[model samples]
Target: MVLPPPSHSRPSGALARRAVLLGTAAWCVGATGCSGGAKSPAAGIAPAASAPRTPSAASSSASASPSAPGTPSASGPAASAGPGGALPRARPWQPGPGEIQPEVKVAAVRLVEALGTWSRGQGTDRAAADRAAALGIPEALAAQLAVRAGSLRPHADAAVVRVIDAQYGGILSDTASVLVVCDQPTLAGAAVRPGGTTVDVRLSRTSDGWEVTALHPAAPGPAEALGPMAREVLAQSRIELPPASVADIRSGAVHDSVLRAMLQLAGSHRMSISVVRSGHPLDVFGTDHPSDHPLGRAFDVWRIDGHAVVDPASSRTLISAFMRAAAAAGSYNVGGPIQLTGGATANQFFSDDTHHDHVHVGFTA
Candidate 1:
């Protein structure tokens, strides 16, 4: 294939036209739409904006462990073949209950588009790549998908995506990550590929909307599968986390003991809760000891079963019981508004103003 020459051609008065374009932009700033589309050179993904917190709610079935047998995907709209034997129409994400923040919604939409197309049935790798790119998946993640998609055969059925969870947080900035769990069941009842269900998507707000900056399980050998018990917590709870937390799970940075304790706690409680921090930097307010969160050895719960930690009386009893449960489950340290005492130990629990709003659960080893 021969290429065309690089012809340096120009129209007359090109320089004068450049001046006119600049003038147009200048006045447009005072007007609507034009100046609003300003781009960030470094973070070319999305513009900055606020994502206020709201109550969270979700409903989903539990996913099983690796050794656990998969339940067959029953005949349904998802199993039906469309034109060209394409997968069925997967549902798009919509804000439910607490996910009403503007920035969060944008992130969720972009994530759905990216994964929804990447895992859609019946498309060549090239087609998948094109679809992902069109949906604004960052090159960091898209490059990875292109290689993986190249080997797979197109699907005989469409896939389904469920919004498992979402987390939004930052220091003097607006940032978020949305967790989408998907599946394309085969007649044999196995996943399209094992560990393909979980995806942690990163995004930041732009003037236009939330733009995805990265995605987890991005470069893959295999994704970590969340067992049935773990999925229950994710589906019903507000375990908000940053990309770093997702990376921890991917790279085996988080300890199994910590994970085990969390699942045990969730199952007993039967209510969704908020994880304010996990596997990220030590967000020490005023030069205290470095926190365990950055090491994936600790997690803080700010909300439990749809109740804020700071809430009084009825909420207090729940928080107190949960803290004890954390201790019995091998948490070496726990902190919150309500302090506890007695044998297994008193030093293990602490009460302070900083913790007035949430319960901090920490683990050793």
Candidate 2:
């Protein structure tokens, strides 16, 4: 399961990026650069049906009893400046491939944050409105959120949405769309449980930067399927990646079978994955042949059960055994520091200085 990292754009459902924005770049399956998935941008925002809504008095049900649930039912928040006040510029930042555009990032972060709004967090109607204005959000939306905060409702901390992955929803000269995948370990209600939520954010270039114009849910795609051990390894292990890589995994855009094999290895032996860039453009670094990592079909393990492949004193049995295990898990190619002489095909395993410190496992599917 992999959900694209989170973002917000206009709310439209069951449409292609092409359908959303005509004459823009087409989306692809890979997060590296595409916009094939997700609904088209709409003129306004809408609440995600799958997303948890602030409970009403009639339904306070959740895994945990709501502490103080219900919309501020007593009063309506004041609205503020409308299209009357000038909005941001019509044209602004345009990023190139592999670039980290700050404007886009800023809009992406704020979009998710805006959803976590609560009367409780701000403590008053005025407080929520103040924050929304500061973030360049519409005043009416802030008031709506402020009045929705119930005394028994969980705090923002109870259900934190951390955006772990991001991708381009679509790009144009002045307008852009972003897809962000977030892991919501604690949603408002106890029954919500922990899971992934993808936010499709539409942004328009502005004089200062990018500002979100709309938001909606992502189209059906791989969902972030990390289990406890996989999550732990991603947190504690030495794995490092380029911006697109995390989004790839977090979105569940990578091959599921391969990811499962890697996760299983990590869970059993506490392996630390060192690399997974083999299938992308960056894979051209050390070898001439095409690599599987770019295809999301392979991963490299730098340490096994706490033993480094490069350590002279590291036990050979551990490395060899791990390689065998990888093979058993359906990997067609396994490379590491230790070379086996028997019980394997000649081309099945390899050892060289290039992989002296890591074990590379490649799956074919």
Candidate 3:
């Protein structure tokens, strides 16, 4: 069974420099980055019939279950204003090849396009501003964003969520709507702001193209960012993988990919993996390690062709060669066999001798 790591083990700390603004740049599938894997060894979660609901409720659910469960919050920044009450509607950009993320690519492009349009309409007509509110805009958020626009400072980076809602009945001719939700900072000069508004966007299909009809802050805010991550993982059958390692044999995204390629290079090698708990290295668990194994960002590969590849001291050298091949192919943080008890090389990081019979390639994010 795959027992998730302690929830407290991972928390979103202040994001790193590159992680900020670079968007999906850090979303690569390697060990030395954010580690994640599938829940069950076979496949991950089933797809929901409908997308999850919006925030307000999501926050409550997350707080109730502190366990590392539920979907990722789809929260992110929307358009902001400049010093003189103007929104920062920057143009959207496209993703490059080999970018592992699909949703991030789509959402980022959409958000940028939405904001850029907003920027062009400053003053000429609050038409863009009005459309912003109509599209489920947050009211109090306007003021908060105004502050961010006036004097932007570097505090902890926040997030932006994208929400899509279908509106029928009551409104004009019944239609479907999509809105980008932005949560502005709550504090200003050491004081609390109340009653933030959620922005709503009304889109219309016109002769020119789809255009924003109105923008308004709805009562309930937009949904969190979790669902999108959940959706992505569900489709891919993988979880986010981080980067951390053991000895010479490291296993993360790059390493795992390398191992697969190495197997291919070595003429059709079949593989099996077991998730033995602590002190049970030689023991095998499941049949196949899912492509996106959730055993942290790292993985342990043993029992090639039903035999163990033990002896960390001597085996480390051979594994080192494997690591080189894997690294050249873009693997990261690939470590080798865990040193257990018995010989001079035993029990270095591991406590028992079971691993003496198999190889542990722990990949990083």
Top candidate by TM-score: 1
- The whole-model lDDT of each prediction reads 0.38, 0.42, 0.24
Candidate 1: lDDT of 220? 18
Stretches of candidate 2 exceeding 4 Å from the true structure: 1-33, 37-50, 53-99, 117-131, 140-158, 165-167, 170-172, 185-196, 206-208, 218-365
What are the per-residue Cα lDDT tens digits for candidate 3 across 44-107? 1111111111112111111111111111223333444333333222222222222222223333
Give the root-mean-square deviation of each candidate in angstroms. Answer: 16.0, 16.1, 21.0
Best of the candidates, lDDT: 2
Q: What's each prediction's TM-score?
A: 0.45, 0.35, 0.20
Candidate ranking under lDDT, highest first, comes to 2, 1, 3
Backbone steric clashes in candidate 1, count: 5
Q: For candidate 2, lDDT tens digit of each residue in 63-94?
A: 11111111011222222213223111111112
Give the per-residue Cα lDDT of candidate 3 at 262. Answer: 37
- Candidate 3 ranges beyond 4 A from true positions: 1-175, 179-182, 191-197, 220-365
